[model samples]
Every structure is written in structure tokens, then in C-alpha cells.
Target: MASTSAPARHVPGFSAPAVGFEEPFAMLEACHERVQRTLALLDRLREHVRQQGADESARQAARDVLRYFDVAAPLHHEDEELHVFPLLLAQAAPEMRTLVQRLQQDHVDMVADWAAARVPLQALAQGEIEGFSESAEALFDRFAARYASHIHHEERQAYPAALHLLEPALLGRMGQEMAHRRGAPER
Candidate 1:
């Protein structure tokens, strides 16, 4: 008899969670989890409109997506910019500099893409529109792809490099600042 296993699923945001803000890297990972979850929700929204039209579920999904990207995503980016990037820029090897620059540019592009998606998404959330434009859908795809790639790069290279570059004191400070930024109690 041949052994069989369950088919692998590609759920984007269901990875292991970050312990808390006390561990800054863990918190960043947690933020990425939420980003994945929210992006998945956006995909569901598209499907919902296709299958069910602009119903209550779609509205709620839109609302959830807006809340996350508007509030959490910016903070996540800020956390990286404030605590992670500077250290890397100053300390990482020469080869990493270009990668860091590209990541920074990604941040800029993400912000712009979010703004473009937001207009249509906000309307959808408010029940002002029953469907999204083709441009909005394309923007969402681009946004998701950019995030997926950005997260991949950070996890694969930048973050691990940061773990080595930053000292204990700096890591502590990063955790504290991250906690305070989120209004989470310092751990």
C-alpha cells in the first residue's frame, strides 16, 4: 500500500505567531502573520463579490481589511524602519546595502499601492459600491505580490542578519519602543 498524506495548503498568513512585543523580532513576525491574514481576506472579498455580490460578509471583510492595513500595516513598517533598517544600513555587509535600499523602496511603493486600493476598498466597506473596478483588482494583486516578496526577503535574509547585527541593549530598546508604539504593555 502506498502511504498518503493530506494535500498541502497555501494559506498565506497562518504561520507561527510572534511571542509578543517583548521580543521585537517575534512581534515583527506576528505583524507579518496579520498582514498575510488580511491579504487573504482581500482575496476572499474578491471571491465574495464574484459569488455573492456586495453582501454583508463582503462589507465586513472590507471593514476588517481596512482596519488592519490602515492601522497595523503602517505601524509594522515603522517598526522595521525605526529599529531594523538603520542598524542594517550601518552594520550589514556591503552586499546587503542594495537589498536594504530595495526594501525601503518597496515600503514606499506599498504605501502608494495601499492608498490606491484604499479608495475602492473604503467605498466597498461603506457599501457605496457593489463591485470593484478592474484597476482596483489589479492594484490589489500588485499589493499582495509586493508584500509576499517583501516578507520573503526580510524573513530569508534581512531579519536574520539583523538578529546578528543588533546588540542586546539595542534589541531591548527596540522591543520597548515597539510595545509602546502599539500601546501594548512592555514585557
Candidate 2:
């Protein structure tokens, strides 16, 4: 029998029927919102796996996870690496280069975590994510753990560095660049 009880699901970070922008911070803030929503969905997916209901949900959450892994995550990384990091690296004290490397390492590590998840997640969406051998629960757990820590580290360490290092002029250029990247017309 199909369960009648609606599972208590976490709310997604975005809810309105529209998307809006308020200028420079909009792209960054939207990325933040995307990560939050995707994390919430990831948490729910983990919960479903814990209940051994991956088969039940058919990994419906995979769609959202895949979208995040492919789009939002990569764009944020690109913005940091190509735009923010280079600006910081150009003028940061020599002593701080190591911090930059460590932050970049965090991005690399998170990419690896996503790499590890892709095949199994793809398979899962194919109606048999693991062929009865792979532990779907284990897979989801590892992905969640790696990604959650990555986000926390950036929020705590990397973002502050960018904020500190970017000059007002560079920041304006960055705002324009990011806006262009997101398809906003010249302002």
C-alpha cells in the first residue's frame, strides 16, 4: 500500500514564482540560496535513504542534486577561481598565498566528491542506482558529508578572504563580469 502520510520534507531555499536581481550581490546571494536549497534537498535525500526508501522515491531528488552538482556548484567555483581568487592572489601578502591554496584545495576536494557520486547517482536514476550491490545510503552519506564540510569551510574562511582582498574597483568589475556571465545586459 502506498503510504498515505506525507513525509516531513525540508523547505527549499527558493520559493517565489520569479527570480529577481538587486545588483552586484545578487549573483553571489543567488549562489548562496542555491546551495542552501540544494543542501536541504540533499539532507532530505539522505533521510529517504536512511528510511530505505530510495527505491520508493526512485531517487527523485537526484534531479535536483544533479542540477546543483552540474550548474550552481561549478559556476560558483569558476567565479571564485577565475574572478575572485586571481584578484586576491595578485596583491595578497606572500604569507597568505597558502591560505589561497588551501581554499582552492577545498574546491578540488569537493569536485572529487561530486565525481564519486556521479556514476552511482546516474545509475540510480536509471531505476537501479546500484544493482543491489552498491549501498545507496552509504553513497549519499559520503557525498553529503564531503559537500557540507566544503561549504562550511568556504563560508568560514574563503569568502571572508575574498571580501577582504577585493578592492572596490576590482569588485565593481567583478560585479559587472558576474552579471554578464548570468546573462544580465550591460548596466
**TM-scores, in order shown?**
0.89, 0.71
Output the lDDT of residue 70, model 2.
Answer: 70
Predictions in order: lDDT: 0.82, 0.61
Which ranges in model 2 have alpha carbons more than 4 Å from their true place? 1-26, 50-52, 55-57, 130-139
lDDT of 1 by residue, 1-187 (tens): 0111213322222234327555789878877877887899899899899789999889988887887788668878998999888888999998887899999999999999999999999999899999989999999999999999999999889999999988899898898897676655445
Q: Which lDDT tens digits does candidate 2 get at residues 1-187?
A: 0011113322223232243333344455556667767767766765666567557474677666775677557766777788756755776776556767776887887787777776666665666653323465566566667656766665666566677876678778877775455454566
- Candidate 1: where are CA atoms >4 Å away? 1-18
lDDT of 2: 0.61
Question: What lDDT does model 1 reach?
Answer: 0.82
* Best-fitting candidate, scored by lDDT: 1
What's the distance in Å from true for residue 103, model 2? 1.6
Between which residue pairs do clashes occur in model 2? Answer: 123-129, 124-129
For every candidate, C-alpha RMSD to the true structure in Å: 8.6, 7.6
Per-candidate count of clashing residue pairs (backbone under 3 Å): 0, 2
